[model samples]
Target: MGYIDLEYAHTCHVKSVSDVYSLGVLKLEVLIEKRAFSQAEEEMNRDLASFALPIIEAGNIEETLDRRPVPEPTPWQLHALKHVAQIARCSVKFAGKDRPTISEIIANPETACE
Candidate 1:
Protein backbone atom coordinates (compact mmCIF):
# COMPACT_ATOMS: atom_id res chain seq x y z
CA MET A 1 0.00 0.00 0.00
CA GLY A 2 1.25 3.46 -0.80
CA TYR A 3 -0.01 4.43 2.63
CA ILE A 4 2.24 2.03 4.51
CA ASP A 5 3.69 3.48 7.69
CA LEU A 6 7.10 5.07 7.29
CA GLU A 7 8.50 3.23 10.32
CA TYR A 8 8.18 -0.01 8.36
CA ALA A 9 11.51 0.87 6.69
CA HIS A 10 13.53 0.39 9.86
CA THR A 11 11.61 -2.50 11.40
CA CYS A 12 10.61 -4.33 8.20
CA HIS A 13 7.76 -5.68 10.27
CA VAL A 14 4.08 -4.94 10.20
CA LYS A 15 2.41 -3.79 13.39
CA SER A 16 -1.12 -2.91 14.36
CA VAL A 17 -0.03 0.70 14.54
CA SER A 18 0.90 0.51 10.87
CA ASP A 19 -2.64 -0.54 10.10
CA VAL A 20 -3.90 2.42 12.07
CA TYR A 21 -1.63 4.71 10.13
CA SER A 22 -2.75 3.35 6.78
CA LEU A 23 -6.39 3.69 7.78
CA GLY A 24 -5.69 7.27 8.68
CA VAL A 25 -4.24 7.80 5.24
CA LEU A 26 -7.37 6.25 3.78
CA LYS A 27 -9.46 8.61 5.82
CA LEU A 28 -7.50 11.54 4.49
CA GLU A 29 -7.80 10.26 0.95
CA VAL A 30 -11.56 10.16 1.34
CA LEU A 31 -11.63 13.66 2.73
CA ILE A 32 -9.23 15.13 0.21
CA GLU A 33 -10.24 12.95 -2.75
CA LYS A 34 -6.59 12.21 -3.52
CA ARG A 35 -4.59 9.00 -3.61
CA ALA A 36 -1.62 8.45 -1.28
CA PHE A 37 0.64 8.93 -4.27
CA SER A 38 -0.34 10.48 -7.59
CA GLN A 39 0.88 12.44 -10.52
CA ALA A 40 1.17 16.10 -9.64
CA GLU A 41 3.17 19.07 -10.71
CA GLU A 42 5.03 19.30 -7.42
CA GLU A 43 6.90 16.31 -6.03
CA MET A 44 5.66 16.94 -2.51
CA ASN A 45 2.08 17.00 -3.77
CA ARG A 46 2.51 13.48 -5.04
CA ASP A 47 2.09 12.12 -1.54
CA LEU A 48 -1.16 13.02 0.20
CA ALA A 49 0.20 12.78 3.75
CA SER A 50 3.29 14.85 3.06
CA PHE A 51 1.26 17.45 1.23
CA ALA A 52 -1.71 17.65 3.59
CA LEU A 53 -0.44 16.85 7.08
CA PRO A 54 1.40 20.09 7.61
CA ILE A 55 -1.58 22.02 6.31
CA ILE A 56 -3.82 19.99 8.60
CA GLU A 57 -1.54 20.50 11.62
CA ALA A 58 -1.32 24.17 10.76
CA GLY A 59 -5.11 24.35 11.23
CA ASN A 60 -6.08 24.62 7.58
CA ILE A 61 -7.50 21.22 6.82
CA GLU A 62 -10.23 22.81 4.78
CA GLU A 63 -7.54 23.77 2.33
CA THR A 64 -6.77 20.14 1.69
CA LEU A 65 -10.40 19.05 1.52
CA ASP A 66 -12.29 18.36 -1.67
CA ARG A 67 -14.55 21.25 -2.54
CA ARG A 68 -16.85 19.73 -5.11
CA PRO A 69 -19.92 19.38 -2.95
CA VAL A 70 -22.81 20.89 -4.81
CA PRO A 71 -23.99 23.30 -2.17
CA GLU A 72 -20.75 23.35 -0.22
CA PRO A 73 -20.59 21.74 3.18
CA THR A 74 -22.87 22.71 5.97
CA PRO A 75 -21.53 23.69 9.37
CA TRP A 76 -22.21 20.22 10.76
CA GLN A 77 -20.60 18.60 7.77
CA LEU A 78 -17.61 20.89 8.07
CA HIS A 79 -17.27 20.00 11.74
CA ALA A 80 -17.32 16.31 10.96
CA LEU A 81 -14.75 16.73 8.21
CA LYS A 82 -12.45 18.59 10.57
CA HIS A 83 -12.83 15.91 13.19
CA VAL A 84 -11.94 13.19 10.71
CA ALA A 85 -8.99 15.26 9.57
CA GLN A 86 -7.74 15.37 13.13
CA ILE A 87 -7.94 11.61 13.29
CA ALA A 88 -5.94 11.42 10.08
CA ARG A 89 -3.37 13.79 11.54
CA CYS A 90 -2.95 11.58 14.58
CA SER A 91 -2.67 8.48 12.40
CA VAL A 92 0.23 9.69 10.27
CA LYS A 93 2.73 10.67 12.95
CA PHE A 94 6.32 9.69 12.03
CA ALA A 95 6.81 7.35 14.96
CA GLY A 96 4.51 4.40 15.33
CA LYS A 97 4.29 4.95 19.09
CA ASP A 98 3.13 8.48 18.43
CA ARG A 99 0.22 7.26 16.35
CA PRO A 100 -3.06 6.49 18.03
CA THR A 101 -4.29 2.97 18.48
CA ILE A 102 -6.79 1.69 15.93
CA SER A 103 -9.53 1.75 18.53
CA GLU A 104 -8.87 5.36 19.37
CA ILE A 105 -8.92 6.33 15.74
CA ILE A 106 -12.15 4.45 15.19
CA ALA A 107 -13.88 5.84 18.26
CA ASN A 108 -12.72 9.42 18.09
CA PRO A 109 -14.39 10.34 14.83
CA GLU A 110 -17.73 8.78 15.78
CA THR A 111 -17.69 10.58 19.13
CA ALA A 112 -16.43 13.79 17.62
CA CYS A 113 -19.21 14.06 15.08
CA GLU A 114 -21.80 13.67 17.78
Candidate 2:
Protein backbone atom coordinates (compact mmCIF):
# COMPACT_ATOMS: atom_id res chain seq x y z
CA MET A 1 0.00 0.00 0.00
CA GLY A 2 2.76 2.40 0.86
CA TYR A 3 4.60 1.80 -2.37
CA ILE A 4 1.48 2.04 -4.57
CA ASP A 5 0.32 5.17 -6.33
CA LEU A 6 -3.31 5.94 -5.54
CA GLU A 7 -3.82 7.39 -8.99
CA TYR A 8 -2.61 4.22 -10.67
CA ALA A 9 -4.77 2.09 -8.41
CA HIS A 10 -7.96 3.90 -9.43
CA THR A 11 -7.12 4.52 -13.05
CA CYS A 12 -5.69 1.06 -13.71
CA HIS A 13 -2.85 2.58 -15.62
CA VAL A 14 0.77 3.28 -14.90
CA LYS A 15 2.44 6.62 -15.45
CA SER A 16 5.94 8.01 -14.90
CA VAL A 17 4.69 9.79 -11.84
CA SER A 18 3.68 6.48 -10.32
CA ASP A 19 7.34 5.53 -10.37
CA VAL A 20 8.14 8.80 -8.63
CA TYR A 21 5.70 7.99 -5.86
CA SER A 22 7.23 4.57 -5.41
CA LEU A 23 10.67 6.17 -5.24
CA GLY A 24 9.39 8.48 -2.54
CA VAL A 25 8.25 5.47 -0.53
CA LEU A 26 11.62 3.85 -1.03
CA LYS A 27 13.40 6.96 0.19
CA LEU A 28 11.19 7.09 3.26
CA GLU A 29 11.93 3.46 4.01
CA VAL A 30 15.67 4.04 3.75
CA LEU A 31 15.61 7.11 5.95
CA ILE A 32 13.64 5.48 8.71
CA GLU A 33 15.24 2.05 8.40
CA LYS A 34 11.71 0.69 8.23
CA ARG A 35 9.80 -1.30 5.65
CA ALA A 36 6.95 0.14 3.59
CA PHE A 37 4.53 -1.68 5.86
CA SER A 38 5.62 -2.31 9.41
CA GLN A 39 3.64 -3.97 12.15
CA ALA A 40 5.82 -2.07 14.62
CA GLU A 41 4.40 1.26 13.51
CA GLU A 42 1.21 2.79 14.84
CA GLU A 43 -2.07 1.90 13.14
CA MET A 44 -2.27 5.16 11.24
CA ASN A 45 1.42 5.13 10.37
CA ARG A 46 1.98 1.57 9.29
CA ASP A 47 2.50 3.01 5.86
CA LEU A 48 5.99 4.51 5.74
CA ALA A 49 4.98 7.53 3.69
CA SER A 50 2.11 8.37 6.01
CA PHE A 51 4.45 8.07 8.96
CA ALA A 52 7.13 10.21 7.35
CA LEU A 53 5.52 12.87 5.15
CA PRO A 54 4.12 14.85 8.06
CA ILE A 55 7.42 14.85 9.88
CA ILE A 56 9.30 15.85 6.76
CA GLU A 57 6.82 18.60 5.87
CA ALA A 58 6.84 19.86 9.42
CA GLY A 59 10.66 20.22 9.32
CA ASN A 60 10.91 17.50 11.94
CA ILE A 61 12.85 15.07 9.77
CA GLU A 62 15.27 14.47 12.57
CA GLU A 63 12.51 12.67 14.37
CA THR A 64 12.12 10.22 11.52
CA LEU A 65 15.81 9.55 10.81
CA ASP A 66 17.39 6.23 11.57
CA ARG A 67 19.33 6.73 14.81
CA ARG A 68 21.03 3.37 15.00
CA PRO A 69 24.22 4.67 13.45
CA VAL A 70 27.07 4.92 15.89
CA PRO A 71 27.59 8.60 15.29
CA GLU A 72 24.64 10.82 14.52
CA PRO A 73 24.58 12.80 11.31
CA THR A 74 26.51 16.05 11.25
CA PRO A 75 24.97 19.46 10.55
CA TRP A 76 25.93 19.28 6.87
CA GLN A 77 24.50 15.77 6.61
CA LEU A 78 21.32 17.00 8.23
CA HIS A 79 20.97 19.62 5.51
CA ALA A 80 21.36 16.95 2.85
CA LEU A 81 18.83 14.78 4.60
CA LYS A 82 16.30 17.62 4.61
CA HIS A 83 16.74 18.09 0.88
CA VAL A 84 16.26 14.38 0.24
CA ALA A 85 13.10 14.50 2.32
CA GLN A 86 11.90 17.48 0.31
CA ILE A 87 12.38 15.52 -2.89
CA ALA A 88 10.46 12.60 -1.44
CA ARG A 89 7.68 14.89 -0.25
CA CYS A 90 7.30 16.41 -3.69
CA SER A 91 7.40 13.04 -5.35
CA VAL A 92 4.58 11.67 -3.23
CA LYS A 93 2.01 14.42 -3.61
CA PHE A 94 -1.51 13.00 -4.08
CA ALA A 95 -1.80 14.89 -7.36
CA GLY A 96 0.80 13.84 -9.87
CA LYS A 97 1.07 17.40 -11.20
CA ASP A 98 2.30 18.46 -7.80
CA ARG A 99 5.30 16.19 -8.14
CA PRO A 100 8.54 17.18 -9.81
CA THR A 101 9.73 15.78 -13.08
CA ILE A 102 12.52 13.20 -13.07
CA SER A 103 14.76 15.83 -14.58
CA GLU A 104 13.90 18.20 -11.80
CA ILE A 105 14.68 15.60 -9.17
CA ILE A 106 18.04 15.00 -10.78
CA ALA A 107 18.78 18.70 -10.98
CA ASN A 108 17.63 19.55 -7.48
CA PRO A 109 20.25 17.94 -5.31
CA GLU A 110 23.05 19.42 -7.37
CA THR A 111 21.67 22.93 -7.09
CA ALA A 112 20.62 22.40 -3.52
CA CYS A 113 24.07 21.27 -2.53
CA GLU A 114 25.82 24.20 -4.13
Candidate 3:
Protein backbone atom coordinates (compact mmCIF):
# COMPACT_ATOMS: atom_id res chain seq x y z
CA MET A 1 0.00 0.00 0.00
CA GLY A 2 1.41 3.38 -0.99
CA TYR A 3 0.95 6.45 1.19
CA ILE A 4 0.65 8.39 -2.02
CA ASP A 5 -2.49 7.10 -3.63
CA LEU A 6 -3.83 8.87 -6.73
CA GLU A 7 -6.92 9.99 -4.82
CA TYR A 8 -4.77 12.30 -2.76
CA ALA A 9 -3.90 14.27 -5.82
CA HIS A 10 -6.66 16.07 -7.70
CA THR A 11 -4.74 16.25 -10.94
CA CYS A 12 -5.58 12.59 -11.61
CA HIS A 13 -8.98 11.27 -10.56
CA VAL A 14 -9.29 7.69 -11.74
CA LYS A 15 -9.87 5.20 -8.96
CA SER A 16 -9.16 1.95 -10.80
CA VAL A 17 -6.10 3.42 -12.43
CA SER A 18 -4.94 4.50 -9.00
CA ASP A 19 -5.28 0.96 -7.76
CA VAL A 20 -3.22 -0.25 -10.72
CA TYR A 21 -0.54 2.24 -9.79
CA SER A 22 -0.42 0.82 -6.30
CA LEU A 23 -0.17 -2.67 -7.69
CA GLY A 24 2.74 -1.62 -9.84
CA VAL A 25 4.57 -0.25 -6.87
CA LEU A 26 3.80 -3.41 -4.97
CA LYS A 27 5.26 -5.46 -7.83
CA LEU A 28 8.52 -3.58 -7.52
CA GLU A 29 8.51 -4.01 -3.74
CA VAL A 30 8.00 -7.74 -4.03
CA LEU A 31 10.50 -8.19 -6.85
CA ILE A 32 13.27 -6.14 -5.32
CA GLU A 33 12.63 -7.25 -1.75
CA LYS A 34 12.84 -3.71 -0.45
CA ARG A 35 10.57 -1.18 1.17
CA ALA A 36 8.66 1.24 -1.04
CA PHE A 37 11.05 3.87 0.19
CA SER A 38 14.73 3.03 0.22
CA GLN A 39 16.49 3.72 3.52
CA ALA A 40 19.97 3.60 2.04
CA GLU A 41 21.68 6.82 3.07
CA GLU A 42 22.80 7.73 -0.41
CA GLU A 43 19.28 7.45 -1.77
CA MET A 44 18.03 9.88 0.89
CA ASN A 45 14.86 7.88 1.52
CA ARG A 46 13.69 8.08 -2.06
CA ASP A 47 10.66 6.06 -3.03
CA LEU A 48 11.89 2.82 -4.57
CA ALA A 49 9.65 3.22 -7.58
CA SER A 50 10.85 6.75 -8.08
CA PHE A 51 14.40 5.56 -7.77
CA ALA A 52 13.77 2.70 -10.15
CA LEU A 53 11.82 4.49 -12.89
CA PRO A 54 14.86 6.28 -14.20
CA ILE A 55 16.85 3.10 -14.18
CA ILE A 56 14.12 1.24 -15.96
CA GLU A 57 13.55 4.16 -18.28
CA ALA A 58 17.24 4.12 -19.04
CA GLY A 59 16.98 0.47 -20.03
CA ASN A 60 19.05 -0.60 -17.07
CA ILE A 61 16.65 -3.11 -15.53
CA GLU A 62 19.34 -5.19 -13.92
CA GLU A 63 20.64 -2.29 -11.85
CA THR A 64 17.27 -1.63 -10.25
CA LEU A 65 16.64 -5.29 -9.55
CA ASP A 66 17.50 -7.04 -6.29
CA ARG A 67 21.25 -7.16 -5.81
CA ARG A 68 21.24 -10.79 -4.77
CA PRO A 69 20.91 -12.84 -7.90
CA VAL A 70 19.44 -16.34 -7.74
CA PRO A 71 22.05 -18.43 -9.53
CA GLU A 72 21.11 -17.00 -12.90
CA PRO A 73 17.39 -17.07 -13.48
CA THR A 74 16.06 -18.32 -16.80
CA PRO A 75 15.62 -16.00 -19.77
CA TRP A 76 11.85 -16.06 -19.28
CA GLN A 77 12.17 -14.89 -15.70
CA LEU A 78 14.30 -12.00 -16.82
CA HIS A 79 11.85 -11.12 -19.54
CA ALA A 80 8.95 -11.25 -17.11
CA LEU A 81 10.82 -9.05 -14.69
CA LYS A 82 11.39 -6.47 -17.37
CA HIS A 83 7.77 -6.66 -18.39
CA VAL A 84 6.59 -6.23 -14.80
CA ALA A 85 8.88 -3.24 -14.45
CA GLN A 86 7.34 -1.72 -17.53
CA ILE A 87 3.92 -2.20 -16.00
CA ALA A 88 5.14 -0.60 -12.81
CA ARG A 89 6.54 2.32 -14.75
CA CYS A 90 3.24 2.83 -16.49
CA SER A 91 1.30 2.50 -13.25
CA VAL A 92 3.20 5.13 -11.29
CA LYS A 93 2.77 7.96 -13.72
CA PHE A 94 2.87 11.33 -12.00
CA ALA A 95 -0.20 12.27 -13.99
CA GLY A 96 -3.04 9.82 -14.31
CA LYS A 97 -3.41 10.74 -17.96
CA ASP A 98 -0.25 8.79 -18.75
CA ARG A 99 -1.06 5.77 -16.66
CA PRO A 100 -2.73 2.69 -18.12
CA THR A 101 -6.29 1.84 -17.15
CA ILE A 102 -6.83 -1.19 -14.98
CA SER A 103 -7.98 -3.21 -17.98
CA GLU A 104 -4.84 -2.43 -19.91
CA ILE A 105 -2.72 -3.12 -16.89
CA ILE A 106 -4.40 -6.49 -16.53
CA ALA A 107 -3.88 -7.42 -20.15
CA ASN A 108 -0.30 -6.17 -20.52
CA PRO A 109 1.56 -9.03 -18.87
CA GLU A 110 -0.27 -11.70 -20.80
CA THR A 111 -0.51 -10.03 -24.18
CA ALA A 112 1.36 -6.77 -24.58
CA CYS A 113 4.47 -7.91 -22.75
CA GLU A 114 4.48 -11.29 -24.38
Candidate 4:
Protein backbone atom coordinates (compact mmCIF):
# COMPACT_ATOMS: atom_id res chain seq x y z
CA MET A 1 0.00 0.00 0.00
CA GLY A 2 3.01 2.24 0.26
CA TYR A 3 6.07 2.84 -1.84
CA ILE A 4 9.63 3.49 -0.81
CA ASP A 5 11.22 6.80 -1.80
CA LEU A 6 14.93 6.43 -2.32
CA GLU A 7 17.04 9.25 -3.69
CA TYR A 8 20.36 8.27 -5.20
CA ALA A 9 22.69 9.01 -8.07
CA HIS A 10 22.79 5.40 -9.09
CA THR A 11 20.64 2.29 -8.67
CA CYS A 12 18.93 2.05 -5.30
CA HIS A 13 18.88 -1.25 -3.53
CA VAL A 14 16.37 -1.95 -0.79
CA LYS A 15 17.08 -4.54 1.86
CA SER A 16 14.67 -7.34 2.77
CA VAL A 17 14.45 -5.94 6.27
CA SER A 18 13.19 -2.64 4.87
CA ASP A 19 10.51 -4.50 2.99
CA VAL A 20 9.54 -6.37 6.13
CA TYR A 21 9.31 -3.15 8.08
CA SER A 22 7.12 -1.64 5.39
CA LEU A 23 4.85 -4.68 5.43
CA GLY A 24 4.61 -4.47 9.20
CA VAL A 25 3.59 -0.84 8.97
CA LEU A 26 1.03 -1.63 6.28
CA LYS A 27 -0.39 -4.47 8.36
CA LEU A 28 -0.63 -2.16 11.33
CA GLU A 29 -2.37 0.46 9.24
CA VAL A 30 -4.98 -2.00 7.99
CA LEU A 31 -5.63 -3.27 11.49
CA ILE A 32 -5.75 0.16 13.10
CA GLU A 33 -7.70 1.96 10.32
CA LYS A 34 -6.36 5.33 11.37
CA ARG A 35 -4.13 7.90 9.77
CA ALA A 36 -0.46 7.09 10.26
CA PHE A 37 0.32 10.62 11.34
CA SER A 38 -2.31 10.49 14.06
CA GLN A 39 -0.11 8.22 16.11
CA ALA A 40 3.26 9.34 14.77
CA GLU A 41 4.36 10.72 18.13
CA GLU A 42 3.39 7.61 20.08
CA GLU A 43 5.00 5.35 17.49
CA MET A 44 8.39 6.86 18.28
CA ASN A 45 8.25 5.85 21.94
CA ARG A 46 10.92 3.30 22.91
CA ASP A 47 8.42 1.30 24.98
CA LEU A 48 6.48 0.31 21.86
CA ALA A 49 9.59 -1.32 20.39
CA SER A 50 10.00 -3.48 23.51
CA PHE A 51 6.33 -4.42 23.47
CA ALA A 52 6.39 -5.37 19.79
CA LEU A 53 9.26 -7.86 20.16
CA PRO A 54 7.50 -9.99 22.78
CA ILE A 55 4.30 -10.15 20.77
CA ILE A 56 6.22 -11.13 17.65
CA GLU A 57 8.20 -13.81 19.55
CA ALA A 58 5.11 -15.25 21.21
CA GLY A 59 3.28 -15.73 17.92
CA ASN A 60 0.63 -13.34 19.11
CA ILE A 61 0.24 -11.88 15.64
CA GLU A 62 -3.52 -11.85 16.09
CA GLU A 63 -3.18 -9.10 18.64
CA THR A 64 -2.73 -6.68 15.75
CA LEU A 65 -5.67 -8.13 13.84
CA ASP A 66 -8.36 -5.81 12.60
CA ARG A 67 -11.44 -5.83 14.85
CA ARG A 68 -13.84 -4.29 12.36
CA PRO A 69 -16.91 -6.49 11.91
CA VAL A 70 -17.99 -5.60 8.38
CA PRO A 71 -17.37 -9.02 6.89
CA GLU A 72 -15.95 -11.57 9.21
CA PRO A 73 -12.77 -13.17 7.92
CA THR A 74 -12.75 -16.94 7.50
CA PRO A 75 -10.34 -19.24 9.33
CA TRP A 76 -8.29 -19.43 6.17
CA GLN A 77 -8.00 -15.68 6.09
CA LEU A 78 -6.76 -15.66 9.66
CA HIS A 79 -4.26 -18.34 8.77
CA ALA A 80 -2.98 -16.32 5.85
CA LEU A 81 -2.50 -13.29 8.07
CA LYS A 82 -0.45 -15.34 10.51
CA HIS A 83 1.61 -16.68 7.66
CA VAL A 84 2.37 -13.15 6.51
CA ALA A 85 3.48 -12.30 10.04
CA GLN A 86 5.89 -15.20 10.00
CA ILE A 87 7.30 -14.18 6.63
CA ALA A 88 7.70 -10.62 7.75
CA ARG A 89 9.55 -11.76 10.84
CA CYS A 90 11.82 -14.04 8.88
CA SER A 91 12.60 -11.37 6.33
CA VAL A 92 13.54 -8.99 9.11
CA LYS A 93 15.95 -11.36 10.82
CA PHE A 94 19.05 -9.64 12.17
CA ALA A 95 21.27 -11.83 10.03
CA GLY A 96 20.71 -11.60 6.30
CA LYS A 97 21.66 -15.25 5.96
CA ASP A 98 18.68 -16.20 8.09
CA ARG A 99 16.20 -14.79 5.61
CA PRO A 100 14.58 -16.72 2.81
CA THR A 101 15.24 -15.73 -0.76
CA ILE A 102 12.38 -14.35 -2.87
CA SER A 103 12.48 -17.43 -5.06
CA GLU A 104 12.35 -19.71 -2.05
CA ILE A 105 9.29 -17.86 -0.80
CA ILE A 106 7.63 -18.12 -4.20
CA ALA A 107 8.28 -21.87 -4.37
CA ASN A 108 7.01 -22.51 -0.85
CA PRO A 109 3.84 -20.48 -0.82
CA GLU A 110 2.13 -22.75 1.68
CA THR A 111 4.62 -21.67 4.33
CA ALA A 112 2.64 -18.43 4.48
CA CYS A 113 -0.46 -20.25 5.61
CA GLU A 114 -1.15 -20.66 9.29
List the global CA lDDT of all models.
0.79, 0.78, 0.71, 0.50
- Superior candidate under lDDT, 2 versus 4: 2
Q: Which stretches of candidate 1 lie over 4 Å from their true place?
A: 39-41, 108-114
- The residue pairs found clashing in candidate 3 are none
What is the TM-score ranking, best to worst? 2, 1, 3, 4
112: Cα error in model 4, Å = 7.7
Model 1 reaches what TM-score against the true structure? Answer: 0.83
TM-score on alpha carbons, each prediction: 0.83, 0.84, 0.76, 0.54
lDDT per residue, candidate 4, 22-64, as tens digits? 4444544554344333335765533222334466669786766
Question: For model 3, where is the 10-residue window of minimal lDDT?
Answer: 105-114
Candidate 4 whole-model C-alpha lDDT, 0 to 1: 0.50
Displacement of residue 75 (Cα, Å) in model 1 is: 1.4
Cα distance off (Å), candidate 1, residue 15:
1.2
The window of 10 residues in a row where model 1 has the poorest summed lDDT is: 105-114
